[model samples]
Target: MIFTRKRQPLNKLTIAHAAYTLQKEVKWLGITLNPTLSPNLHLRMVKTKTNNTIKQLTQIIQPTFGLCQREARILIVGVMMTKILHGSIIWYTNKNRNTVRKKLTGRLFQAVQLSTGMMKQPPLPCLELYGGIRDITKQNIRLAHNYLHTKLAALIDDGHRTLIWKDLTVPQPIHPSPLNNLIEKNTLLQQHFTRTETLSPFPVPPWCHRGSWKENKSGLALRNLELTWRAPKG
Candidate 1:
């Protein structure tokens, strides 16, 4: 696909003695790339897939049948959400595009409603609140922020980091990338380094022993003490 905002004629080209034509859109690495680089097509495809999945899930999930509320919530989070937000880091932005956001959220809210066994009359905020789901826009921003942080952490050279930082944080009057929008929305991201750094090292250590700790008195006592210390205080 030829990515550009200007009007241009599609010209055929020959590669390795084979003639090729320009495509209106091309799917690469699961993301749809169009001539204008707009995410509308990709979002539409995702919406269709999500709707189909929801339809199939409705068969097994009911008000009081196949799946309980807790199981429904798990499925929504683990399956539906993962599918909906699949390449969101590349396409999502919390800008002034309410039309796109509304369409996406409306479809997503259906899954939440199904999980919660509620009708469609509830507002988005109410649906998200009772459904125990995060807003799509917020989640996209979070994923972008995490992506940025991870990228920054991986860069060892200060010069490379500075270049990347300036490129992403620099103000663009005309058009801004998703990362730029994220930085604009959260001023804290403008900092050279994130205040809250998260690390996911290789072979993550287990939080506790493998076996049943309740069998050992000392382990049980330690667990209770830890739980008490971590518990919310009144």
Candidate 2:
């Protein structure tokens, strides 16, 4: 952990969720109404839904932290939060270091709740899976027989999605955010995450990391998603 995001500690006075917004971006190509098609944004609405799971993250983030209307947002079109999940390798910071450590602690390990599933999307002709995301668009593989789909399959089979630990009684692989911890991930909690914005190296199941080209078929990507804690249905 080399980077540490800077922030002033929580004094109860600075714990303001109203000052923030959960804006994360999704990069994709879009197909419009008729002949015209281009890249578009699939924004997720954070507005409290009837489903208990959807509100889980927003409830904590909305009142406890001081985030803005993003509670109604699912995705922010062009923004992303990869650094918070996958972590940084080259230039690190305090914001990132603390975030990294808080995320792996054993105590909160049991508290994390995740859902694994998938949504319908299209296919990409070829995906340029960037490695060691920093500043370089480095190339990894040039598939001959199969392209992105095959690569996504390998990621899923290898366990990119299938790790859920709602009970925390068992050891589970960590990924998805909006995770609850006895201890806070950000020591100096702020309205928004100030640490390095890093992406997981295939952290979310291939499906979670899916795009126009390939998708994770196991429905394990649910681990990266969050839903409100509802009492089990009768």
Candidate 3:
């Protein structure tokens, strides 16, 4: 299959003497990735799965001849929700993604109410009040931050540095930094470094200018500091 993105060259190219057909989206590693690299398709898939799970749990957690409120709550939260939010950290980024996540969260909230013999169609705030669940969006943000922190820590501890870190030593005048994508996605990492002028497990490179901690009091100021991994060749 040919993977042609929007507004790109639509040249019909094929290999091994076979023609290829263009597809709008493709399933990769159990995630549906689209031409725009958005997670909308994956969100819909998750929504369906969550709905089915909720329905099945609801039947088993009925008030009579079923699990009690506490038992149902534990099972639904620990098992169903966990299954639904497996890879949320990677895809749950923008407002649209949050909206999709809210749909699942709302369903979970309703399921909690149903299991507890409460009103099924209660308001959002009422659900939080009774269900005692944190804001789903905030939870996703915290999960994303934790995932990023783990990745950074592992990169720092690796015996052999990645190619991107290795590129920091090379004086490439024409190319941009390979770490730009990482810095863009994980803003928390940038904020952490900005507050503390320390990149542990890696020494301050010659390219990175070490400014006094007092020089930038406001953590909001995003200064373009030249960070490097190699020492200056004096």
Q: Best-fitting candidate, measured by TM-score?
A: 3
Ranking by TM-score: 3, 1, 2
**Candidate 3 Cα lDDT to native:** 0.37
Off by over 4 Å in 2: 1-56, 60-90, 94-96, 103-112, 116-234
* CA lDDT, every model vs. true structure: 0.34, 0.23, 0.37
How many Å off is the CA of 67 in candidate 1? 5.1
Q: List candidate 3 segments past 4 Å from native.
A: 1-48, 57-70, 78-95, 120-234
lDDT of 2 by residue, 103-147 (tens): 322112111211111101211222335344433211111121133
What TM-score fits each model? 0.24, 0.16, 0.24
Query: What TM-score does candidate 3 get on C-alpha atoms?
Result: 0.24
Q: Give per-residue lDDT, candidate 2, residue 146.
A: 31
Q: What digit string (tens of lDDT, one per residue) describes model 1 on residues 120-156? A: 3323443355555557644543444344333333431
Model 2: residue 173 alpha-carbon error in angstroms: 25
Residues 141-226, model 3: lDDT tens digits: 34433444343335323322211122123332332222121123335666566432222213222222222221222222223222
